[model samples]
Target: MAANFGELFLTILLIVCLTVSSQGREMMEKKYPYLRLASSFSSAKARGYDYIIVGGGTAGCPLAATLSEKYRVLVLERGGSPHGNLNVSYLQNFHISLADTSPKSPSQAFISTDGVINARARVLGGGTCINAGFYSRASPSFVMAKGWNLELVNESYPWVEKQIVQFPELAPWQVALKNGLLEAGVSPFNGYTFDHIYGTKIGGTIFDKNGFRHTAADLLAAGNPKNLRVLLHATVQKIIFNTRSPRPYAVGVLFKDENGRRHKAFLHAGRHSEIILSSGAIGSPQLLLLSGIGPKQDLQRLRVPLVVNNEFVGKGMSDNPMNTIFIPTKGHVEQSLIQSVGITKMGSFIEASNGFGQSSDSIHWHHGISSAEIGQLSTIPPKLRTLEAAQRYAKTKHEIPREAFQGGFILEKIDGPLSRGHLQLINTDIDTNPNITFNYFKHPRDLRRCVYGIRTIEKIINTNQFSNLAEDDSYTINMLLNMSVKANVNFIPKHTNDTVSLEQFCRDTVITIWHYHGGCHVGKVVDRDYRVLGASRLRVVDGSTFATSPGTNPQATVMMMGRYMGLKMLRERLGRRAGV
Candidate 1:
């Protein structure tokens, strides 16, 4: 049977692409032809390598690919390979794997605790394998908006986008959604958003003909590098550390391959040798602690002698409190809308200049505007601006001021912000899953703020700007005013200045959108340069180092960070040799 509806293609591709996992017995035969894991560990194994990268994930895959250009690089992946897996090739088939019900092998496994949020891929490709194909670049305003230098991120954006092949337009069958928002008073912002951010008026999805998700896995496959060795279904249980001088240095990695036997893999970082930890956020810290580089208390608990007393190593934990508003429209809209459109084939019309439709691929970007621009829009009601901006935005393509977007418009985090969660060992046994608590909505402001944000969304949806056109005669534009919905709505906890409907949404409706971040944050675990402050010759390169949470999806930004760090490592190596 052919696709029943349009959105199915996008929905399917978005689910499966480049997921990486441990190369276990379950899938020893189902890997890509070019890459394979080591069968058995040899004590006297060949150890002369320019660099050894740990954790083949969002950061690992890219780092391995980039460093291989000049150095002999070895990527240690704990998961099995899903390379050339057909369930992944055809977009429709990808959704099944999203189930993650494939019984995990001792050597190969992936942890999916939430229905929507997939933790990390225990496969050769990492999260790219299972994440919905929502590839978005870092917001420019998000970059230049503050913190890191603007020019550096600006330069890196082009570099990473080119490597990842960030799509430029919506796939065929996807509605412009831009038109639906004319009533909402929003506009197309040069950044990334869901298929559509504005109500009634939304945006389109980006995709290709075959509809395969294009993640780092695809990028590496395309590069076809010669010397890159990707070890799949291989688990790195510990990092061999040396503490003769009272400071431990990571000199090697202890891993278990498909057969469940242990092997010692050494890191030779002298003169031309080094080890870069590009492991996904969770894996990075665990490996570090296994190697004895995490918090002192954690290391002691595991009976693993600590080489460093970095309390912040695994403490800064933070994941974006990302939640979605599923407005069930009258028809089978999700499927019908997607199957009807493609990126380049669709019309360019949109509502807000800062909303959607202007750029086919990304929904928003950093417009690099001024404080004056922000002040100008400050007084304008968010709902009216959303409606007018979205309508005017659909007419043509133009850049909107990114600064005006400084504080995001997606405000549903009503209660105090959730406190950061921690990752602790549930069992010292490396194979056992660790204890991870996100401590969601722990802060009082989290519920309140989220409630407030939703109100804003409701206001936009209910306003005359939206109701005038969206409401029906049976339902006065006033009837559609959401008064009934609002009346029945409970934004906070009841019986005590709070409510229930919103509470359920807070506790269950939201989770990290595969964007878990800042576990070993800057100023706490590792320095801004991503080096473990107290430990020498050890560093983290994944999302663990994210200083603060990025309000949007973090793949492009994190991958670029890997690239940037790779270059910095090389340049610094050059400097150390030059005797500067």
Candidate 2:
């Protein structure tokens, strides 16, 4: 397996190097002059920064760029730069990146307490570097519900779209998926749109026509290079607080570099200066808890110094549950990621992908077996599965030569799952994943939505558009769906029976679309302006603050929110300076 990866890595590297012209290489360097290694980050400049943004991710990158337009901004990313990483930069290597179990891999794999295997972005671009690259704006209702200035939200979307989003030319498999969706009565076809309309539509992708992925890290090119300083491989251990004042507030952050050298980055004394946490859903809350701002009992048990004691810090956690079925095709299907989507009013989103597999030399290590290769493990029966077994099973699912094996997946994912969970710290290590559970199907409504979504997928399979790709008429696509939804509850904790019902299948087969949001939510943890309720000069501006996952994919809105909120903050600062 190691030998296989080495050859694959070399080939991918050669491809990436050839694809990037000299002019392109020069442009990238010039575009991000301020980006540097954490070792080069000088502590002398700590107090000079106007804002210290943790996590140079989907929200953090744009936020730093926008703020750097006027202020001295610092972005500390725990991961390395995404500039030349073949796994992060190429569309075909998506699953390979996630399958990489190395400590420095761009995708950080983790299992939810609900027994679902998931991943978090460990690269500068965050999830944008590791995601399916689907791009679409949030629904108007989503904007309205968040009480955002709809005009500003509208303006912010274009700012992000212009930089990274692109209209994807549909692959043959994508066209088939679109036709099948429409044939299944999803709705009026909305072709080549970024709007989140309830219909079959072709959405934007971050991967350009050349199949090179453009991540949020690219947004840093928009920053004022002289004012913005990006520090890579800087893991922020905790937020330093100033308790001397009547109101406790953040003063700086204590972070460590790759070499384990600790450093402190302090904010300028400016009244509007702040420490923003764009460390993502799992990250933001975990940081807060580590910093002694979460439930008092948890903090006390952990023996951390309490700062504000906000119990809701890690509350309201939710993940969109997805159920998928494999569709093996006899003929060739071109490889593609998410492009076509069907947004049903029934609170589910339908999507598909095809023709992703590894070469014969590395078939044993191929990671494209699980659905769209999102690398899920919950699909395996819990009682018989370990992480290694699940991963090994996923990788070696295809025994035939790569060319001989061909298939795709049709997936249905429930939206805005009402089922919620919480996150708790296991230890103080900043790099350690906090214990989290989505409590999938805890609410009966979530199960019903899953059933509805799965049934819609059945309708799509039954359509002639999809039948064209199937191996034969005898193939039963809905075999799993036909199973019962009820049985005596005899399973052990987190384990289920082999002949599970559809409802049990929804629970048993549940996996993350990696769109999990809410560990710190709006109103409960942060205000309308995204300011932490009980803390000063601290705010979380990422998916962690979302009450509901936006649209089909939240990256667009996440990027938009970063820009929108940064503009708002800049205006506020300018207003205060002008004595407004």
Residue 286 shift from truth in candidate 2, angstroms:
0.5
Best by lDDT: 2
lDDT of 1 at 409: 19
| TM match of model 2 to true structure | 0.88
- Locate the minimum summed-lDDT window of 10 residues in model 1: 367-376
Candidate 1 per-residue lDDT, tens place, 1-580, comes to: 3565557876666554323234443354344433666564455866655677777776777667766666677778777655556544434443334433454421122222222233456665566665544444444444554356565555555665665443435421123233323334434332333232222222222234445555565445532256567777777887676778666566777788878878777666674465677777777777777777777777888798777777766665665454333222222211211211111101111111111111223333211111111111211222233324433443422343222222211223221135677777765676665655566666655665555444444544454543333324453434333431322111222222245565555555443345566667777777777777776666788887765544234566666676666656655666436321
The per-residue C-alpha lDDT of model 1 at residue 262 equals 80
Off by over 4 Å in 1: 1-34, 40-45, 103-118, 140-152, 168-182, 188-207, 221-226, 269-272, 334-418, 456-505, 575-580
lDDT at 535, model 1: 63
